[model samples]
Target: MYALLQSTAVAPNSLTVIDFLADFVKFWQIIVFVFGAYQFWANRRERLAADKVREAQELLDSNYQAWLVVNSAQGKGGSGGRIDALTNLARNAQSLAGVNVDGAWLVGVDLRGADLAHASFKDANLQGALLSGANLKHANLEGANLSAAQLEGTMLQGARVSGARFSAASLLRADLADLVGWREIAAVNYARLQEIQRAPHGFREWAVEQGAEGNAVSEDMSAENFSTQFRAV
Candidate 1:
């Protein structure tokens, strides 16, 4: 091979070899870099799109829950039949916004993973309802009864809970940051309990003498105090 190379002088110049190698390496490096950038940009775009979809789904779920509560309250009697009706009604009401279903007797209803944003549930009866992981943003629950309700991991942001009864409700790990009038209700409940515990010996008689109903518990206690009265008797 050496004799043939020396005869033909086939060995390329060193400068030519170096230039060819350098250009080849530079071209390959540019190709790799371009592909890497494309892959990075595509992945980033997909992640952003997924996040937007998740956010929209959450909002839709919240509104759907509010509609279910309204229909359950209006449709009365027939037990199983009413529940079937409610199932259909909820499917339909999901198309609308800001549902109003108040004064309904909803004991032990399972509303987990529901969305209840901007719903009006004034004076609703929701004793023992399971509302875990539910979204209740901007919902109006004024004078509603939520006694013993499971509110674990529930989102109650921007909710109006004025006069709402949560006497025995579980709020563990629930989001109450945007709840309106939460502090006021807590103070009111505390005051009512203090008044009952510190009542004078003749307070009952004095209340009656002053035209206050002797049997009346505090104003906030009217809905829940019936059991208290029964226990006292």
Candidate 2:
């Protein structure tokens, strides 16, 4: 009779130990599930970001290829219509970050609102191109042909413009602060000189010394009439 009573007491203790183990296991399982879910979320976000980068790279590549085709067709004396079509494709490309279009023939291309920060356009022909609202911060424009290019509201801070041609280029509301080699551009007439907004310290004095004149030359000119009376001097 005593043995039977001891057995019954030990059974309850065993049941309690089993219940604790089961609960512990359940807790660990929940923790593992939460950790797994977090890992999945983190990985998914990383993948999405990588996908965006890839997409941007692909777009840039397409533009580059189209530009090359245009150049090649021109070199071969091909029909102007085909070259124009290819040029249009290149011009309308989106997300051109970190692209290298150095020495490219991109004359008259529409690059408005492009993300061209840290891009290389060295010796590229960008004459008459629409570059309004483009982000050209830290871009390399050395020896590039920018004559007659539309640069309204363009961000050119820290851009390298040495030996670049800005003759006849519209710089209305363009940011030229902290630009590298700003004094070495090919030309800076009154019209181009008036486009500078928040011009680097002493740049206004330098422009005045360089013979720029007109209503846009004053520091207190109304914004509406600032570039309206711009005349090359």
Candidate 3:
């Protein structure tokens, strides 16, 4: 009888040990689950942030390419004249502000009403390009080929036109106020005379005395009518 009572006491102690082990295992499982959930949430947040950065980079690249296409379309003869590319750029001209297309070929491209402020087109081929109403304020066109390019109502305030060719380019009603390096422009007689009427005060008469014909400005011409004639068609 005494041995049987001792065996019963040992069985209770073993049961207590088993219950303790079970509690410990449950605690460990809860800790692991919390840690795993935290890691998953952190990884998701990182992925979202990376996606946003990539999207921004893609948008910037697209804008840069648009500017390049328009610049390349401004080529002379066989070098340029991609009408489809020019059409695409014209449709998205608002994104072209401050684009850098330096030394590009842009002959005969239609760039009407483009926002080209602070853009770099230095030494670019803009021969016969349609640039009516373009915002060329503070733009760099130094040594660029602008022969026969349209410039009606274009803003040339603070623009650098040094060594730029304007052989037969039309400047009718174009704003040339405060143009940088205006005296150094390589312009023919017709090009020089076309913008003389818009020159500041005595500058017009001075140009006329310098052999620039002053009869190009019609007395019956009005600013509204002049702008209408040069509107992009």
Candidate number of the best lDDT:
2
Candidate-wise lDDT, in order: 0.58, 0.71, 0.68
Instruction: For model 2, name the residue pairs that clash.
Output: 171-195
What is the per-residue lDDT of model 3 for residues 31-113, given as tens digits with 9 covering 90 to 100?
Answer: 99999999999999999999999997976676567556656554333334343454456656554567665667667778799
Clash totals, every prediction:
4, 1, 4
Error of 2 at 89 (Å): 6.5
Q: TM-scores across all candidates?
A: 0.44, 0.55, 0.55
| Winner of 2 and 3 under lDDT | 2
Candidate 2 residue-wise lDDT, 99-165, digit = tens: 6667767677777887888988888877677788999999999998776677889999999998887
Candidate 1 weakest lDDT stretch, 10 residues: 186-195
What's the residue-level lDDT of 87 in candidate 2?
42
